[model samples]
Target chain A: MTLLITVFAAVTVTIIWYKNAPDTSMQLGTLSLMFWGASIMWFVDAVVGYMEEGASFFMQDAAEMLNDLYLGLSVVALGLIIWLVILMIKDPHRVIRSLITGTNRQ
Target chain B: MACFLVPASEAVITTVAEKIIRSKEKNDDSNNASSVPKVRFSDKLGWLNKMLWGGSALLAFEHIWHGEVIPVFPFLTAVQNGETGEMLAEMGTAGVGMAVLVTLIWGGMLAASHVIENRKVDISSEEAGQ
Candidate 1:
């Protein structure tokens, strides 16, 4: 289920990035790539889980599914946080610099 | 060890940042000949970024509401014990649903923007012909 959710998110973001590929200012491609990378990681995890648990893996209880969901959400959130930090560091719009220098009037 | 994954993830983000910078520089050089205004980073992906941040905030709130943020050690244990797992599942479902909705809305906006831009071009060209 976690892998499914991440794959869905990754695909949606990738479509958005593809539509705007010519415009590189916003860096949505980075976000898309991050989600795709995560999706691949989760896919591997799901495959390994299925291999170990065999058919029982398909019979996950509600509690187990919930736990997996939480873990997946955490991964997504962490990815966003990392992306935001990188954006700040890059400061493509000078917003971070303005904030630090106290010069931004807008 | 799981903590080590954070740095590895960060390294990927750094590579993305470098890619964006390099692309932007190339764009600037190409546009210089045509005297086109450079695209501002904030303006380009502002909506998408906001949606991502908003989703993260919602997830964080849900985590806190379920007491998963505090008592971190117990939170890990609770995963195995099935405590509050149902609530967590519901929240996760809602969070992902919201993300999908946001993406759809952004796509709609992009299509609308493209239509408006095309209309403007058509009108300008018509006026110039007149």
Candidate 2:
């Protein structure tokens, strides 16, 4: 099923990136988990929809749309998560300085 | 519409500003004290929580609009297949179920990630503080 393929790709990509990357600050484990989980769910749903008795084109279309939504959100969320991770890892000092500015804490 | 957009925009701006400030604080602490860690557990969890809530809102809106409102139009329903009701029900159930699952998983993973990350950061910060 398309959903299954998408989920597989997403999860595989995430694990590969997470493990092989020299700097895991590129992707947070939690965000990757979310992407994988959602993709898997969509994949499962698609498979089930196809096998269910009396499944129609209308229903199939709806299911596909739902999967698309999940995939889109997963990409957007992961992208943001990756960027944040990189930002934090690369400039902890600048971040710290900004926080201390105009604050009571020294 | 303007009223809605204005409040939403303001909230988004506030959130981004807060995140930048928080990240800066963490970095500052790390510098004066190399012992401090770069990221915190709560920060990751907070972002995950926000996403879950945002997703829930979108799903709810979809449920109301497609599952209820659109299907209820008199002319549309008159011409639509009798099975429209059943189809809507299925869509509603599936959409809601998936939404809930994602939200719960995200929350749980966020919590776990937070704990692990926080422990690492705490160890570093403690050393730095010393």
Candidate 3:
């Protein structure tokens, strides 16, 4: 199931990039790398979850704690997505500059 | 829930407006004949917003790894003391929510302040140049 999702995410990203981004080697490479990195991180997270899956009652509680932590992080991520959209709309020029220069807003 | 986006949105708009106002102030103060220095306050606020956004993204990435996309390990079957789990869960959930709320407000404040300081910078530059 996890593998399937990972593949789906990667393919989706690829499709989006192919359709939206300019046909540049750098863009393609960057997209591929992003998917690969995300996949690897997801894999590690799943492993930890599975390992704790069959533990004792106390262990299960610990796993649950970890799971909650994960959920909280998701909220933060959603916040960021909102932030990014806001930034793009409110300051498109600045956003573009930041992206091109790789220098954070100072 | 729907209204939550308003404060943050307003902050960004106001900040940008302030920047424009400040720039205009500098331009009008032709007697000063000085280029406006980038305002420190606004710059700092920009940094704060970036940090908040970046932090949030990292948190989300962590969530995705754990929740929906990947579970590298087997499921945790061990159940700890039910009472303790319940307490910890409550605390964690609350803590996360609070952290996000605080950060959002902080970002808004920073943005608003930046706009004001940007104006100040414009005025000061004009004065100095004169």
Candidate 4:
């Protein structure tokens, strides 16, 4: 469940990142890389679980799946929060800087 | 249960490495006005750190929420429950695999950026008709 959520986030962000490749101000690349890294990690875990449990790996009960979904969404939210921090720090377009200094009044 | 420990450990090492490289890179290069923009080694390592640290932290949180990790002496429930062997196996396989895969992907990103930077140099040189 975490794997699916992260993979979906990764793919969506990657597509958006590529589409707006020249606009590096948002730091979408970093966000996408973070998700990709997570997706790869969870993918490895799923594979290892499958190896150990064989066909039973995918047969999770509703409770377990619900827990996984919550965890997955939390991971995605944390990733976004981290990305937001990076974006603000970088201030690639100097939006924050401008807001602080009041320089872009035009 | 303790699988995220592997990548967390790797993140710690790379964080130290980044500090060392950053110290080394404190030298000046602002004099060379015509050179291509250099991507600092410390910065690249920083990207790897971000990937590793962020993922490991979230995974740790997940484990904590699942009650696999605890705020106790042994720390890990697996260790307390005599499942240390299974925990170690998960760490060896899933944890190591994730760390390696993330590092490899970071390396690929580095290579791709290097190529793009070189392309910029080529375009500028073409403008200069060199």
Candidate 5:
């Protein structure tokens, strides 16, 4: 379930990153890469688990699936927050820098 | 239960490797006008580090949420529950599997980027000739 969610996020973000390729300042590529990486990680986890638990690997409890889904979403949200921080620190558009400069001038 | 630790530890190694590589490549990026620019090894290593660290972090969080890991000693709950054998088996399988797969994926990504970089160089050369 977590793997599926991450794969979904990875695909969605990859598309957005591609569309926004003209603007590299936002660093959406980093977010996209992180999601893709996580998806691959979870893919392996799923495979290993299937080997261990056989067909029952997919037969997780509803409550357990819900918890995993929340975890997946939380990971996505955390990634977004980290990316936002990077964007602010990068100030690729110089937004923060200009703001500070303008305030200093005033 | 302890699967996330494997990738997390791998992340630490790669992080240190990136630092060393970065220091070594501090002044090697100067390309002549006719030269085709190439990606830095350090930057590629950085990308790998990011992947491992990001995935491991989220996996750890997920494990914690499931109560598979705890804050106290013998941090994995499976250890405390006398499921040591099962936990070790999981670490051997899921932990190693994730680490290997992520590295393989990063390799593919690196290859794709290298091919694109070369293609860009070829196009520019063709345009220059014209």
Candidate 6:
């Protein structure tokens, strides 16, 4: 379920990035890449889990599913946090620069 | 062999670090004359990023509220307590719904930006003609 959520997010972001490829900035690309990376990681995790648990894996109880959901959301949140840090570092539009120079409003 | 590998790796690391530092300095100089427009606090992309962060915070809070993150690996079957099946169903629904909503917003933004760019181009061409 966590894998599914991340995959959906990744696909959605990728489609948006694709449609606006020429004009879109690196931030969007960064977002897409992060989600896609998480999805791939979760995919491997799911595969390993299934291999170990076999058919029982599909029959997860409600609590386990809920836990997976939380974990999935955490991963999504972590990815966004990383992206935020990247945006701060890049400061593409010079917002940070302006702030530092105290000439932001001009 | 070990000594050779270690020094070779150190040299590679040092070269990469120097390159990164040089590029960062160059970027700092060029940033003053960057072509990209300055971002305002009310920028649409900025709003979107904020919204994403807000959602993430809410999810984190939810995880904490349910105690799904403390004792063990939440991704695996670590917790022994079980939840109602209905609650599980609702969570699944909500998760998918949130994903869909976010995607729709991003798509809308993309379309809006494209239209805005085209209009700007048209206006510029008109000014040039005049």
Q: Which residue ranges in model 3 land beyond 4 Å of their true spot?
A: A1-63, A72-106, B1-6, B25-130
Question: Which pairs in model 2 have colliding backbones?
Answer: A92-B27, A95-B24, A96-B24, A96-B27, A96-B28, A97-B28, B35-B124
RMSD of each: 12.1, 11.3, 14.7, 3.1, 2.8, 14.5
Could you tell me every candidate's TM-score relative to the true structure?
A: 0.46, 0.41, 0.26, 0.82, 0.85, 0.46
State the weakest 10-residue window (summed lDDT) of model 2 chain B: B1-10
Please provide, for model 2 over A1-106, each residue's C-alpha lDDT reduced to its tens digit, 9 standing for 90 to 100: 3344435555765677768666655454435444454453454345446656445723556676776566455555544555476557665346545665754433
Measured with C-alpha atoms, the lDDT of residue A41 in candidate 4 is 79
Residue A91 displacement in candidate 2 (angstroms)? 18
Model 6, A1-85: lDDT tens digits are: 7778878877887798889887555577768755753454335445545776898978989998988787777766776677788
In the order shown, the chain A TM-scores of the predictions are 0.83, 0.44, 0.37, 0.93, 0.91, 0.86
Say which docking band candidate 3 falls in.
incorrect
How many Å off is the CA of A8 in candidate 6?
1.2
| Per-model B-chain TM-score | 0.56, 0.40, 0.35, 0.93, 0.87, 0.49
Error of 4 at A59 (Å): 2.6
DockQ of 2: 0.10
Sequence-dependent TM-score of model 2: 0.41
lDDT of each residue in A22-42, candidate 1, tens digit only? 876666766765565455444
- As a TM-score, model 1 comes out at 0.46
DockQ of each model vs. true complex? 0.04, 0.10, 0.04, 0.54, 0.64, 0.05
lDDT per residue for candidate 1 within B6-114, as digits (tens), equals: 3233334544665686678678777766322433433334444444443444344435545555555654334546656654553344433444444455567567766
lDDT of 2 by residue, B1-130 (tens): 0111222333365457657877877777767864444445446545544443333333333233333324355423312546665654554555444545554665686677678877998887788789
Best by DockQ: 5
User: Candidate 4 local accuracy as lDDT?
Assistant: 0.87
Q: Name every residue pair that clashes in candidate 6.
A: none
- Candidate 4 residue lDDT tens string, B1-130: 9988999999999999999888767754443454567788899998898778877877887798889999998999999999999999889889999999889989998999999988999998898895
